[model samples]
Target: METLCNNFPSKLTFGHDAKRTLLVGAFALGTYQGVKLTGNFLAGVWKHLLRPGYDLKKRYASDSSECWAVVTGAAMGIGKEYAKQLGRRGFNILAIDKDESEMEKTQAELSRLGIKVKTIIWDFGKISNAESYEAFEKELKNATNGLDIGILVNNAAEFQQESLDMISVDRLFRASSVNSLTPALLARYFIPKMLARYNNGLKSAIINVGTNAAEIQNPRYKFAVYGASKAYLHILSSGMREVWGDKIDIMTAIPRQTKTPMCPVDYCFTATPRAHVNAILSQLGHESETYGTMTHDIEYYMRFGMFGGFVIDNMIQWLNEGESKKLISAYERRMS
Candidate 1:
């Protein structure tokens, strides 16, 4: 009795008047908020306009001989870039990834910088259930054994674009686990260590890379789980930072589109991984959350500030609906 159409339901609807009124209200709110936020945006620009400044250099100019940084998904893209930049900053790196070959490449590259490079080869996707998570926890403990980790970048993520009904339950589980659970667990594991360093007057930082997908309204194209998981990260970072702000510098790096293997499109706004990582690194200790790229920061303000939340929300809904239809049709054609 199951049909392809049944798996891909029709898009939701709002009558014409309702939608019109909503759009008008959203645009109005956006304009007002945009005007109000312009001041704060300008202030941020003034503060961070200069990069790799004397103060920034001095802050991170520690001997870093005993310091260590742990980067998840360190095999490629943003994670790899983070590892490379951190290594160059004089911190020994613990690079974690399932791709042994890519990790080897990463290790070889970082080794040239003369920093100690240790690799942990493990699949974050295998962690689909409680038992598996426990095993993963143990495995992680063994991998990080005898290491003093000062920085943790919870960057590993699972992104599968599929409709809700069409997606297999197992796929959903994997996406949720890697996107949210892994980061949450890793944060829990490393935060105490960061705090412990506080007594010694040493500072530690935890960076969580978040996505604008969290702000999108009614995410379609099978992005429901991904959006929700990223939203969880931002919320988690905010709350945790409130409680541990004095002890450890917890930051949420909200990145927009960047040129990574994971992203399907390479739009003009899409920042190169190096550019994005460099922007983020330069802002360390200056802000708790950042767009990490100048273009993204402007995009964020325009989308949410000028266009307003309502406009952004409605645009996402419309776009998702269109994309979902195209994807569903393509999938059905393939199946047929």
Candidate 2:
């Protein structure tokens, strides 16, 4: 057997037929993988983009008479849009935010839709601390009184791009409070009510607004406690879905560039607040996790699907670093 192996011909001595056959097999394997990837990509496109998505009215059985929707960070950006859309969908709104004036405006706008609008002015950024937590809980309890909450949108967040030494311990803690702790507390407070409502034949949903960066480990976003906090929320939502079973709908929407005050206004693949929130609402019960926009869905498959996390992380890091530099310049101009 050893002698036969040693006597095997080298590639140079192979017959034309053998070489052609080997080449054909290699091409066939490559073609198979290419076809598989293409099929997966197309299927994802059909599900996320082309699909009509979940029908909110049908999900709630067309009865939103006494249902209330709670939206954190409801003053501006995607959060504000969530409040408005839900209000339009016939759900009364409880808008929670740090900005009293902005929330007042939101309340007025939502009120015009003939839906009750309750504004709760409190700083979620301080929610992790005992003193602030107690105060927030008190406010939440009062705000939720006599209300049957059918949906909870955890859209509040804090974001900073500072290196370890540059970011204060206080800042880190606040980011954690806003992005992670507040969502957990809010869900804990409202989920039981949602479940009770569900048992009464009312459907409920929880949407944890997440970030694409949370799914990828990019060192450039190392200073982003925002991503880390969102990652915690992402995993928490996944577990909550399992724990709640069919009692309530749970989703974690990981969006890419959304044109918000916190993010660059003209970034590539950026979606308007209305567009972003629409995508999120459409995909709510249909998917436990989604990119939240067609552009984000395409970007996700192209980046994560084709190159995996490492290259995707580097791409994100490159974008983040550029945005950070722009932020620094803008800050310097403001200071000067």
Task: List the candidates' TM-scores in order.
Answer: 0.78, 0.85
Best TM-score goes to which candidate?
2
Tens digit per residue, CA lDDT, model 1, 153-267: 9898766567677678987887778888788888988887777777766678888998877766323346677788778898999998999987877889977778665664544
Please count the clashing residue pairs in each candidate, in the order shown: 2, 0
Model 2: residues >4 Å from true position, as ranges? 1-25, 61-64, 217-222, 307-321, 328-336
Clashing pairs in 2: none
For candidate 1, what's the RMSD? Answer: 10.5
lDDT of 2 by residue, 105-153 (tens): 8778777878788889988876766787888888889888878788899
In candidate 1, which residue pairs clash? 30-308, 162-222
